[model samples]
Target chain A: MAVCCPLLQHEGERGEEARRFSLVLRAADELCPWVEPVALGSCTLPARGPSRFFGGEARLVDQLGAAVIGALDGAGPVQIGAADGLFAALLAARAGVIVPPGGSATFLSSWSLAVLRRPDLAVTLQRLGIHTLGQFAALPARHVLARFGGEAVLCHRVARAEVGELPGLRDPRIGHRLREVRGELPDVTPQAGFFGGTSAGDLRAAGAVARLQARLGPEAVLTGRLGEGRDPADRGRLVPWGSRPEGRHPGRAACRAPAPWPGRLPPPSPMVVLGDPLAAELVDRAGRPVRVGATGLLSDAPARLSIAGGPWRQVRGWAGPWPASERWWSGRRRRARLQVVDGGGEAVLLAAERGRWWLEGRYD
Target chain B: MFVSTDQGGRAKPDLPAELAARARPVSTAASRLLPLPDALAALFPDGALRRGSTTLVAGSPGGGTTTLALALLSTVSAAGGWCAAVGVADPGVVAAVELGLDLRRVVFVPRPAGAWADATGELLGAVEAVVVRPPGAARPVAARRLAARARERRTALVVLVDHAGGWPFGPDVSLTVRDAEWEGVGEGHGHLQGRLAAVAAAARHPAASPAVHRLWLPSSDGSVAASPVCPASPTRSATTAPATTA
Candidate 1:
């Protein structure tokens, strides 16, 4: 048996329109687990079980039409057909009729050679005045093979209602493609109870992240979290994804709740905060090194900034010197921050500690 | 002062609502396109990120490339779409949060080391979107294979580059932040506030002309919003931003 959902168009309908087509497959799948997607719009399965359960093929087709039409959302009419094989069933589907049991040969007899989809063979047969399957069937099997070659033998069998389907009729990639679009790509689909309520998107993400972690050490793949802190770096931490809070002392591996922290940089944190601060130099216009003194003030008005002894970039604007002190319980230490916009229109956060400066973040 | 003007396309802020909307696995794939925040929507020909397409967000080292790339992923993540960031090294989580991403839906392969391509390839079919930043100029053959794989899987692949040329192949959509103006900070007064980035978009469609628009990449409150100001010229000559008082 086969049903063609109107939603599947051959014009690359694999995108948005493909969803409804998948729905038709789902409805069919509910009736039987072995539903196979034959092509863009049509699918097939063993008709015996579903037909028997519904009392007869006609009754099953009626219920299947209702279910598939609902899935289509009125997109188009659903075509249902059942016969001995895929070839006859698809032809029966087009005619929107059920072939009686043992009636596939009678049903397929009147159809033209075009249904075989072999244009060259169909053209040759048409020129020979054997226009319909019945006429082609009337020819002797040995003569058909001797004249038309190997493929004609298969077509002759199909015309005689022997084979279930043609080679190109069923797209073997349909199931694989549908599962991929649903983010159900793992060879062995992990059961749902294992992950409560996470979307297929999330499951897909988890699978990919796991693969990357396996390839590049567990610590490489991470998830970001924000917590209470005074600077961008302290506020945002990337913990190895899936790390247990108990493994790193409860409440630390995961981000803590946001709390008021004094001297914190205000709204709009830097986009890229460096893990390893790059050494930088700042100087006054008179060619003198600029410093942040003990009073949390600049020793001189800075005019130029150079990163790691690179070419000097004229400073266009500046802000900060927000002093934050810590470790007073052990030993007192102080650090100050500054935001500067260079002449090239790039903004960077520069931090000074112990009279040394380094690039801390970039507002990219 | 930058005021946020919400776009019709911004995703729901609540995770529960997004989860509820996720029950229909088929509906998401129906669009063949991923949603983008309104501010960046006009950049693409379809006003959405087409699945299987590659978009390159390019700019200088400090020219808002990171911010724009994150902004591109924020709406999708907020909508409960799974997103992966490869080669970001150290991402500012607060910045990502403030930019509108639902952190729970985003995974970061901050350091892919030598297997960046492999990591990205593994993620293409599994996630709705994957953001990759190659450590250096990517090789043509490797880039070609990745692009082909992305197309085959129908995943939206966003490549972040220091400059457009860093990617060996031309992308389906190419967006570059030409320049930006800081609105709040002065020589020594106020604080670091919003930035109005002058961005240019050129999609591969032959019928559509390239476009330029100014956006508050990190508007006053940290979310990306549209700027009321006119776009700057393509010659990169003008900086027409008037610092609006917040």
Candidate 2:
């Protein structure tokens, strides 16, 4: 197995340049589904199978180098190596060397003990005068194991290219852990397939909404359903996108009015139902505050009403004065509802309780 | 190395007109016009909602503003088109479903207060049709800008405004519910069922004679059906100004 070691070098490239790197990976995936492709700012591509398909090992390496350089838009210093195992291939790739079959031990022999990646062993090897992999491999396995334990014995075998008995010796996936130090390869995202009619458009729309939700909070995309209630505020309810509508089942109630509450305002629902009722002032022509008596009669006819910064308009016609009181026996609730049209013909729903008035909503 | 920049190089000859025509961009205007409910077919110039155009639907609150708006969106939604409502909190989901809007296909932005215009702009890019109620008082400049954006996006925009007032800016066309009377209710009793409304509409550029029709706006079964045209009242001309509902 031949592994191509792509020189990563620049640390800053992992941030903003990650996108360009992923594009390169995607382009490589399109060319060949390389087994256990590892990306670490730089990438490793095991070239054995692909090398045969592209005509030869040399041709495959050339094509891969071209593809990487193309993806990076001519960024260079892409080095590749071919050998019996990844350990020897990685060492050979650093020197831009390619070792023939059966030459693994000779290829690894010249490398220094530091290439073993166990710094403590490297320091010990240096102190013991075994400065190179060839010299380290010359030491007896039994002596190395008894003195240095199992970890150094394994490193000694890798250094001598005697790794055939080791688990996952030629497996590319073994290098995945090392690749993760920089960053993990993103999972292959699921994509929408071709479908007839507006489904394609719908998927595109859903994608846009998802992106909006990601940028803003989850509440940004909301779904609203009409809920059952006499009060307009309770009538329209919104829930987070994709969730089931809660509260009353809008289909259960025929008129959207709870059965016990009889006098729900008929047709001409307000255009805008104020979440909170706005304070209103209603006075009779004589400048006295108009009040609704206990009998649903006005103590003085309302002459003018003003609400929410809009100019005070003259009252044209009036109806209702019906009781909107809740829990009468508790002594907690008291209010009278009325439908009043201004001189401009804009009708508004008003509730007056204890000489205080509120503009509940306006008819659209 | 000599590079041949021209496509096909010198070796390949231009294809015949019939073959070349296949590569030309096709116009989508005919298919872009969306269907409308049977009752509203006559209101539009093309008898369908045209993409990239704005239509204003104005009526008194509770008088059928929501009903008519839902009716306008029904056909499109039934055809699998996605619809959006901006700055509209509760679209009376019951009324919407009753009037034929598929709830699954609808997206609502309950409180679009400060971001109403921005939200509408975002929805226009994705939805096939959008109904927007201006947050607070309407602004002419913003309305005009949004109208241009709708044209660019090719999304149908239905502006829901109060019939008692005028739109901040003129739309490509306007449909106003002149008067609406609820049926299935008497002086004292009866469950509410449907509405009878007189709708008058005119386009910026007239498609035909002014469209005035009396509609069983979502008749008892929850679908808009045409009713006989009511005689034009003496006090107001349906074509000229907004008619106050009696």
Candidate 3:
């Protein structure tokens, strides 16, 4: 069971709002340890153990309400609701009612189906002549699963007050927002993975990642993935690490050698794939510029190369002008890729498009 | 040379520490060392990545340092150890797979900017290994702090630098990729098939001298393993970078 404190009038001045929120939280903390500040003007906490300590759920709610009202001192109306779950408790607080234990379903029986907050489902249920939550709850669970699918089954559970929490009911960033309101630096963290237990290394790594995210903004920490693409840059993707569930390991899928694709550069993938390819110049032995024609053939063998107009180096070994006309559907330009190794043993992959070459990556 | 120091304080004062270090069996030292692949073991004094030790990988741009550093994390990650990389900008995911890094075990803060030290410090004890490339020259204090934290945490730290002097703190093992030569390609013919990298190691041990090794950064099979010198190869130190394989 959970209890909710919904402040009807705590949002005028910035300082005053912070003051009221903290005071409400302080008062709530005196009664229980797991006080969660859900938003600027609302909070929730577990009621089972605290209810037992205060003799019953009603006494805890009354004591909590009195303490909160005392802290506010006629600042506004304080509606405290105690019920089986977050959804029921939030609505109960809005209605200013203390629903008796296991009577949440009975209390919610009178509410309109719109209170479920799934407007589409509400419209569909209403079309089926189910207007109130009680009417929706009376539908067979198996039939709900069959006709409405898993999400509607969840709504059906919430309609019965069986499960108090729904995925979209609570704001995910409430904690970060509240911290910012308190003039504290906020650390954003995603919800824990479905796995219930974690090892000590996981705990430490999660803490470090969260700290880095807070310090360096969210996008700095990243994990790499090589999806299906012919271009090396197209294949290598970096996603903001720790911003999603990590139970899906990145190993099994990434470790397998890339499945052969037509026009894919052969093995020994480049180590340095430039995010923005640098302009390069390739020329033949006669000091004539080399170009890849529409036939996907080089006009002349590249004998010298210069990247970004740097000093020209003797191309000791070279291969390929493999056609990779990727953007042709939108812009009718032809593109081809070439591999070159200089006398210094530096190997580079270059893409020739629009009669010019660009340094794509380095096989360092 | 991370022998089980259960024999540390005990009466081995006259037993010459070098002898003991060399004689210690692989089994006992393993608890303190992350296992190294057989191909790379010959380059390290302990034949493993020592716990709480800093290893420096220095080379010119495109001189195979990235491949070496990523290669170090492969076995450790395959063994289910967590590893982190900081300041390795624009890492190639396909290449990382080619280098055998289990992407799941590796975390990258590719560009930490001014907070690189803090990020590396925070991850030292947390992950089994941390490979970092400084965005700029590292300060003495920052370098010392990271090295000290790594030493105390039993974490393997691999620092990538463009030059030998780039890292201010002393390192346990310093591997510099002197040069590399691409193989299996001709003048405008075949594609890239392999690369032979010339690597040199300078460790802190008093008796060990700096040694140069020739190995394939990515061999014909697309894996890093030791190389046998090609008999007819010519050394090319005349133009672009440093001295090449003789």
Scored by TM-score, the top model is 3
Model 2: what TM-score?
0.50
**How well is each residue in A1-364 modelled by candidate 3, as lDDT tens digits?**
3334344233442234544566677788998889887656778888788888999878888888888887776777777777778888878888877777799998888899888778999899899999999988999999999998999999899889889887776667556545433323211122111121233455566667666766785578777766776899877777666332223544444555677778888778898888889999999999999998877788988889999989999988788888886766887856789998887878899999888899989987
- Per-residue error for A312 in candidate 2, Å, reads 2.7
Clashing pairs in 3: none
lDDT of 2 by residue, A109-160 (tens): 8888877767898898899888998999889999999999998898888877
Winner by TM-score between candidate 3 and candidate 1:
3
Write down the C-alpha DockQ for each prediction. Answer: 0.30, 0.11, 0.39
Q: What are the per-residue Cα lDDT tens digits for candidate 2 across B1-246? A: 344555434233455785444212111334668778767888888888888899998876656666677678887775556788876764555456656665556777766667778878887868788898886557778888889999999989998887524567778778888666544432213323455677888888754667777776656555677764444642322123222221
Weakest 10 consecutive residues, lDDT, candidate 1 chain A? Answer: A186-195
Models ranked on lDDT: 1, 3, 2
Candidate 2, residue A245: the lDDT equals 23
lDDT of 3: 0.75
Tens-place lDDT digits, model 3, residues B47-159 = 88898999999998787888888888877766556688899988877788777776665788888888899999989988889999987689999999999999999899999
After superposition, candidate 1 runs with Cα above 4 Å error: A1-196, A246-257, A329-331, B1-27, B232-246
| DockQ-best of 1 and 3 | 3
DockQ of 3: 0.39
Top candidate when judged by DockQ against the true structure:
3
- After TM-score superposition, the amount by which residue A222's alpha carbon in candidate 2 deviates from its true location, in angstroms, is 3.3
- Candidate 1, residue A194: Cα displacement in angstroms equals 16
